[model samples]
Target: MGKHRAYKFRLYPNKEQEMLINKTIGSSRFVFNYFLSLWKEEYKKTGKGLTYNKCATMIPALKKSNEYSWLKEVDSIALQSSVKNLEDSFNRFFKKQNKAPRFKSKKNPNQSYTTKNVSNSIQIQGNRIKLPKLKMAKFANSRDINGSILRATISRKASGKYFVSLLVEEHIQELDKSNNSVGIDLGIKDFAILDDGTVYNNNRYTTKMAKQLAREQRKLSRRYEQAKKDGKKLEDAKNYQKQKIKVARLHEKVANQREDFLNKVSTIIVKNHDVICIEDLNTKGMLRNHNLAKSISDVSWSMFVDKLQYKADWYGKQIVKIDRWYPSSQICSSCGVNSGKKTLDIRNWTCECGVEHDRDINASKNIKNEGLRQIQSYDKIG
Candidate 1:
């Protein structure tokens, strides 16, 4: 099967390139917001939203207008891509895949613009990438881009770092078939508990950086207050801007740590296991618990599961998602006895069959058995 992948690399733009990038980002945002407003009015009158082609048709007229003549200063493809994005957002909303589209805000720290490859307009050289207006920008070409480039998205993060992500089409070889299988139980106390009694501890990246983040945030708040008292806008305050960047950098650090941890754990699990079993957790519902919410979010179980899913697909592995309603923790993995419900405080329990069960380990074992059973049933049906 053909596969699509993205190669993201850090970019170092020169002063002129940076200015052009900023201009394109602003133009893209303006185009999206402007067309979005028009789309809403059109939908109100016709009971149908504007499609991508319809939105793209307005770009030329918009550029010719006196008020929007500045739109011609940026790459035309970038503006069209923005309209495409807006249309995609609306389509997803109509299909109930996501919430309704909202207007892009200029105050948003993170900004991005997408442009497609046309007549080799986008290409990678020795240590740089060539984009439409911003000719040759230096990037850390850590690895070779091995596939046909479909499109590129250039983004500026809150930490003021620029990155370019290239979406490419490529063919990948599937991994050899294996008999190895494992079940995993995800939790806050332990990031993962395997059926074989192996445990991966949660790193609590956010918790570790919380103290420093709070300090920086407090300083930023103080700066904002001083700026307001001096009759200055928060954006115009140099001290406030500096503190904001500091806070953003700290948050970025925490995110990087968490991502690194998840990527390593997921890779190991997918590479080692052929059939992986995990619970289909209702993360949104779980987040409702104010007491455990911070700890739960810190563990990032959803991200781990997502990574596992994609890696499994990439490597010809299988992921079995047992229903969330399964009482894996309460059941006896040895004798298949449904012991009465237990509270979170109970870590271990002895079954009537004389089996000593650790809560998480028992859960993992049960998950494995149930998953294998489900797979076998599917095989029989087939």
Candidate 2:
């Protein structure tokens, strides 16, 4: 089987290259928005949306127009890829996997454009990458590019950092089989509680940076007000723009910290255990509780599970998700008895089987045993 992976590296473009990169970003955004407008109009007039091929065919005509002649300045493949992304968005919306596609905004902090590799149009030579229009842009090149590059996505973050993510096709060797298995219980108080009574505390990166974030936001708000008082648009205000970057950098810092922590924890768990079991949490529904929403979002339980899943796939490990309604917390792990549901306040409970249980630990143990039972049943049937 073919394995796909993406490697992202920071880009350092010169003054001319930076201008070209910005132009490419703007052109890609314009193409996406223009086609989106046409798609909306066509659907309204004929009750049919535009397909990828149809949109792609319109690109040449658009570039030929005097008003949109600038579109030809950027990479043609990038524009086509943008339309393809729109098609993907529509498909996802139709399948109920995501919301309907929205128009791309120039003011949006996240800007990106993707281009494919056609007969080695995209290549990494030493510390620089040769793009279609922006040639030989220098990158950090911290790691060697592995496998064949299929596509590359150039992106600009809110912090004004440029990055390129290369999607490559490669072969991955599965890790050796291990005998150990584990169950994980995720919570706001603790990041993860393992079946073996190991608890990983939540790092709370957002909360840790909340004070600085608040201060920076306040500064941004003040700048906006000053800009309004001076009869200048917020976008044209230098102080407001500077403050916005500051706030964005803080937000990016917190996000990076959270991602790093999650990667390490997931790697440790996936590497140590062969069979991993976790709850299929309804994160969307859980977020409805306004009181714990911030805390829950800060912990990012969903992201942790996502990392675990991909790592498990890569490492030839097994991941089983038990139903959310399985009452692992309320059941007695020692005896096959279901104790009545207990409120969250009851952290410890004594079951009728004369077993004292710690709520999270006991739940994890139950999850592990139940997951093993499920695997055993499947094996017997097979």
Backbone clashes under 3 angstroms, per model: 0, 0
Measured by TM-score, the strongest candidate is 1
Tens digit of per-residue lDDT, candidate 1, span 1-382: 5688788899999988888888999999998889899999999999988889988998999889999899888999999999989988998899999999999997898999999999999999999899988888999999887778989999998888899999988786778766789999998899999999999998999998888888889988889989999999887898998888889988888888999999999988888889999999999999999999999999988999999998898888999999999999989999999988999999999999999999999999999999999999999999
Residue by residue across 1-382, what tens digits does model 2's lDDT show? 6688788999999999888888999998888888889988998999889999999999999999999999988899999999999999989998999998999988899899999999899999989999888889999999976589999999999888899999998877788877899999998888899999999999899999989999999998899999999999877999999989889999988998999999999999998999999999999999999999999999998999999998898889999999899999988999969988898898999999899999999999999998999899999999
Cα error of candidate 2 at position 266, Å: 0.8
> What value does the lDDT take at residue 367 in candidate 1?
96
Off by over 4 Å in 1: none
The lDDT per prediction is 0.92, 0.91
TM-score of 1: 0.97
In candidate 1, where is summed lDDT lowest over 10 consecutive residues? 170-179
- Residue 69 CA displacement from its true place in model 1, Å: 0.9
